[model samples]
Target: MEFSWLETRWARPFYLAFVFCLALGLLQTIKLYLRRQRLLRDLRAFPTPPTHWFLGHQKFIQDDNMEKLEEIIEKYPRAFPFWIGPFQAFFYIYDPDYAKTFLSRTDPKSQYLQKFLPPLIGKGLLALDGPKWFQHRCLLTPGFHFNILKAYIEVMAHSVKTMLDKWEKICSTQDTSLEVYEHINLMSLDIIMKCAFSKETNCQTNSTHDPYVKAIFELSKIIFHRLYSFLYHSDIIFKLSPQGYRFQKLSRVLNQYTDAIIQERKKSLQAGVKQNNTQKRKYQDFLDIVLSAKDENGSSFSDTDVHSEVSMFLLGGHDSLAASISWILYCLALNPEHQERCREEVRGILGDGCSITWDQLDEMSYTTMCIKETCRLIPAVPSIFRDLSKPLTFPDGCTLPAGITVVLSIWGLHHNPAVWKNPKVFDPLRFSQENSDQRHPYAYLPFSAGSRNCIGQQFAMVQLKVTIALILLHFRVTPDPTRPPTFSSHFILKPKNGMYLQLKKLSEC
Candidate 1:
């Protein structure tokens, strides 16, 4: 072969460089073989899944962007720990008592979750630990008391009623088939904004064109993508390598948006009346509570602190209910008889467009059961992360070292055939007061357990109850035959195809 003029001078250097790279690759391969021995030793020190030399058990949990961890965890059952590089973590904690210890602050195990989240969420009640978490939960408890939550009932009903109107329109024009999952997502977004921030997302009215909703939806999608990639690529590696810049840049964007919202809320509160003459001096939505919420000595929170919580509430509060109810709808569509039973129960409670109240909400047993069953089948946040501050031995004699990342596979707990009878079936009656008692105390924890559990649990349930109640009261939901949707797990478990359903106008009937 004749070499070109360009190849003559540089060809020798190029060939030499290639040879050097080949030699270096061989060296790394030998090092890799040595490293595998250490990895095996590391796993033996703690429980780990049957892991590979180079990747550990990373393959067992890889490429699960579709929110399939529940299925994965179920298969493993805690026989062996999952190996992720140097980290030996358990995929499922089979014992409820052990899982409870993992979720609490009082366990003396020294827990931490500060790695992936920003500082904004660090100090907030939902993510805080120890005394701070205790105090914050205490102070905020009254804010979501039964009566106080009752006040938000009207708002939730109106929001859901509005969604039903739009859904009716979509079902009407589109051959009785539409991917209504996107619509459900938008509806949940709107309800959260109204209840959490007192602002309307109007995603239903505008179909996801609003900037905040659009940004968050897009951001959530991107963040999930990054999270999936991060599982394969270590965080320390990311920080050392070029990928760290992407994490930094994206984190900055998220903080910027949250910061802006916090500032705007603060500005409104500072200018607005300090104390209103009516009832208590509370702000209408969560912003008022967040702005006015004080620490032990009565010092107000910083804008960043307030924003972090608002961001947490907005993200957790919004996404969770959306996933639960979307799953409820999907389940109902899959099993139409249950859908009729839910509707009949709602009608029995409401009767002729009557508004829902806390008392009325309490009486809707079937409605609550449906929500519980949906959560059982598909928990919104299916995994919980906790780190041990020191080597802590479990009651079962399993000891995990400090700095180990514990993945509390919730989907495993929710679907564990041992805890729940007919676990795979979509059965709401399992949650009725009598039957629900049969399950282990912590086994059915969709919102989780102990101190660090979701504070917005009640808030989410109330909002979901109203939304579900109103929709059933006014509309009859049937699976849209055209695109019959399935789930695509993102930040919130979303539908693969949109949840399209034919809404039979109940008033006409």
Candidate 2:
């Protein structure tokens, strides 16, 4: 009788605990079901492609599905519902009027991005929202002022020349076509190191062995892969995975590098080193500006804030710009006539001088048009994402609730048949002054649009013009007929098979 009573007491508690857990789980499942149903009802107004009950539209949205996406765009016109999973769906927008209306709003960035980016970049200006974002934006504005950007032109030209010299040596020795993306990536990294941190890394030459460069590249791949893999979204599951382990290791290397620079700069500032060496320096780099900036109330960024901003700028400044320059060269190779015109225009302004000036950048109008057109067809950054903070009503009278996630498809908008008269054609004349004036203001958002546009746009433009002009001055680029590129879009738009072109050295005038 005593043993029976003891067993009953223990078994009763166990049974109750099991019952409680089962009830809780049942309630949560029902809650999710209701939420999904509500989302479907709200989004019923927009046309969507067929979706799996479990997979949603995941199969059709891979990086290589551009043709499928284009077909859907043609069938659906302006906007459509994109379901990522059984419960989560976002509106994919492509029309210019719809894009303008959506981008002009003050909605915060998508919560989806917030979950993934913080592990890599921390909560910098790219990820921040509300009053905090505004504060950081104001503090960092002076770093990109015209005077500062003008000074960076010299740094940019030096980096470009370094890459060109290496290419000249390679081309002289062999007749093989060159894969230019990796080379351009290193050059872009070198420019950012010199222009932003005032450090000359020589990464363009030693990229194979550079720890910081390797870490940045690996970490970018891991983050992009994690974003697409739904199973890796959970913190507990990701923490135990192979990618998560690699991410942690690479992040330590990157953080250590950034921290060392911050500490060195801090020590220099304390000793009055930078302030005392005014004659040696023509202008301040991004590090000096951010370290010294103060808000209206004399507030400055914390050490954590400084690290986040530095890392964000370091990553953002290089990758997209590299993609832009590579695609521009590829497009020029495909159209030799356009290439010759751009080369002529560049030579006319530069006139045997390798040194590019700020004024000369303005004179290469045809070259600038070519760059803009390339961006339209293959935008470096293809899409911008946002989450509505309040109900948004489109120009067509369609309304999205506050929590809806929206993707502004820059690629689709640029290719929209309604917006451009022959979207597929590589026509630089489409960007002429008269033609550009008649287009919608929201059209041609290679660097994005609105109040939250890219902070370093002027810096990027100067770098592109300087790099391309110097490259054209040195080599005559032609497409390799044996190897054509396949386009893919992850974090940035890139050629799947790598960008290869033949480089014939130009005879000196």
Candidate 3:
């Protein structure tokens, strides 16, 4: 009787539940196995458009000693795809307006640049979200103000003179023309050091000896450097192996340098040197403002916080300036008529002075256009990254699955002929008020757009104008006929080799 009752009520249901669980478990097991296999054979299984698995398309973006990528970007104006690890991303933006809107799209909390920036910018003004970023921006505004930038004009003039003085010595030697990029790099580096870390640095005279500043140079090498710097090549075999000692070695050196600078600045701040003799400080260095920066409830930044923020500015503000100036000079060399027009404009305003005041820099509207056009073709920070916050549809009517990274193809969009007339041609006139005013708002994104546009945009423009004016005033630059010059693509776009140019002394107007 008991067996019959149990069979009638419990047996069927228990059997059904057991079968259901078994089916679920089997499905999960199969899914796990497939995922593992996918991870193992990721390089082979992915549908990529014709690229060697070993190099993938990294050699195109991360090219070593080649001008090929720069030419390739302009040469091929279409959608391209590349792999970064197991993830595949699209670089299909050739239309300028599309590029603009994609980058500008932001979330409710803050600007949308947390993904790529986390590895570099951290919780600084650049990568912070909502309240944190807004506070940081407000606290830091006093640092980049016009009156503050004006304080550092003399240092720029001095730096320019030092560069010219050094160049004069080098050019005097028989067949001794110098690498233009290196000089600009040094000039920009020196300016950033003085303005950013005026505590106890003489990067102007002795960068090689100063370990802290020297380490800052090495930091860039560690992050976004050429493969030549890597001790071991990455692969499936390497990924499964034990962590290498090389990673620790590079990390320690960079961390120690940043820590030291940050600590010193803290002590200096606590000592309270906010003002100087005669009841006025002549210059407003980065530290001066950062030290004074007080967040909500009367709190200031920690040492590590300041360290990361300072590092970000040095690389973005200074290094980019150098790269841009070098490329702009290169373009001017290739297009002498444009160079003559630029010089004529400069002459009309300053009458061939070695330098211009920040006010004068504002007045040179045409010069600004030429710089914008150069950056349009050759942007310093080459890539824009935005991680999808939610499953959303683009204007193209494609619903992207959530958790995918969006890589805006800056290089492809820059040369898109649909938005830009005669895209291949280097025409500053394209930026004329009539032309740009009518074009789609997204057509030109040299400084990027929306919430996360470069904080130091105006500051950098001043730096570029000052440096470019100085170079044109003293020298008429022409391309070296001996060898074809090319640019190498990196995290920052740089020359394939050092910029070799023929610089002849210019006559006074």
Candidate 4:
């Protein structure tokens, strides 16, 4: 009876299909094993921490543990192989010389970022490479010119003042410490909306339930989760997962919001609203610049292109700035002397005026030093990644082949004792012109270095100076001991819990 069942035509086809599937699986396994072996052979020169055979180094290195990272950095010296799984690893570069060598190359960004971020940011400057990147960069460069940035100072000041007013109310009404990250995040969003979208949004004063704001936060969490969870790395698997579905829904929300704004701007432009050259130069925002921009071929950015850049700016502009400004405040709170010194410098520059000017921004030398030191200690974007496009040799004669992934640990570089004495100390003087000149140029990379550096760094600096100076002028910030901040390194380095601080209203302002 069994022999007769096996002889059936349908049974023969089913058996063949099963055998084929088995063969395919075996082939994939063999291929992966060979690739892993090749990678191990290539990376044999670099030191690496002990890794599990199956789990790799995921157990040893975690996002929360800075001490363990420091130990690894010390043991590995210049660079090390950080294995994510049996078949995946990155050549982690922390040495200034290694960073300088790799960053100067025309290497593309990591393949993982290219795979993951395009779904959200849609091949914006942060995601694009080579010719397309060059074209978009040229077109958008004028949007951040000094003249354009100068016009944004007033808008930034107004946003900061609104935040201060809220802080004043809270300090007067209650005796409790305030979690400042949320407030600063909202304020930064408010500034980005006015300056980038040319729209005024009372994000700081309003509730945080707005769809755009909520979507950004949730989507970031999902993307960061996907990056670390190896199984979710596959588009097919991720799309079928619950988080993936949520990502699609939230992405639509963000796109719809931006598309609406772009359409409104287009309608206004079509209606022939005109401005004189001087007026346009003084008042044009990022939206205006990109909308009217034309390339060498007299081509304007497609709606998709504009949408991508806007989404990139909206997320990059506000979230990172909020982290930076909040951390700067936290550092200053911990070191009262530095805080007082920065406060006095701002006072000297502004006198009784609360409004900051473009010229006065330069005069806050001490404050700038504090800001730099804060960024060095707690960089907003802690790690930068690149995929080598060609074989590269480092200063120490170490070599990595093309197609290898390299991670530049800005946190490790900043904390490396070889680069800075007493790396953990909050010393603003470390950034003084004399001391800064003595250090390696790539040793401190808050906005990264090279052509792929943060495009909005100048704009971020202006906002930082304006917000910090104004806040210092009005309120004296003190750390809350009961709620000391814990560090979390997700997409951005931020307080794990929240940045809680006591704000005492100052009579000076």
**Of the candidates numbered 1 and 4, which has the greater lDDT value?**
4
TM-score of 4: 0.95
Write the residue-wise lDDT of candidate 1 on 1-509 in tens digits.
35686678778898999999999999977786666554455346444434465455444444443334445445655434565454333334645666776775343221323444542244577567667666667766666777668778887777777777776666664445555656676777877777666665567787665455555555555445444453424567657655466556656666776677667666665777435511342336777776777876886667656776777777777666777887777777677788888888888888875577778788888878888888888887767766556666666676666655566667677777666777789988898888877767888888878766677789888887887878777666777656666655554666655566666666622
Off by over 4 Å in 3: 1-48, 51-56, 64-80, 85-94, 107-122, 173-176, 199-222, 225-247, 277-281, 352-355, 507-509
How high is the lDDT of residue 117 in model 1? Answer: 51
Error of 1 at 504 (Å): 3.3
Stretches of candidate 2 off by over 4 Å are 1-14, 276-278, 507-509
C-alpha root-mean-square deviation, each candidate: 5.7, 2.0, 8.8, 2.1
Q: Worst ten-residue run, lDDT, model 2? A: 274-283
TM-score, model 2 to reference: 0.95
lDDT of 3 by residue, 1-509 (tens): 99999888988898999999999999977885675344335323223355554444665545453344434545544334454322333334445544654665563322223322333444677666567767777778778888878877767767776777667666654444457877777778778876776643445455534443344444344344422222233434333434324334544665666567667766765677545521344777887677668966898777656766776776677777888998898889888998888888887777758556777887777777888899887887666665556654555554444444556656556766555666667899888889888878876777777877777887888888877777777677888878555665556677757788887766432
Query: What's model 4's lDDT at 312?
Result: 85
Candidate 4 residues 10-107, lDDT tens each? 68888899999999999999998998999999899887888888767665444578788888887776888888778888888889999899889889
How many pairs of residues in model 2 come into backbone collision? 0
Which residue pairs in model 4 clash with each other?
Answer: none
TM-score for each prediction? 0.81, 0.95, 0.79, 0.95
Give the residue spans of candidate 1 off by over 4 A.
Answer: 1-62, 65-76, 85-91, 104-113, 119-123, 173-175, 228-256, 274-283, 480-486
TM-score (C-alpha) between model 1 and the true structure: 0.81
lDDT of 2 at 444: 84
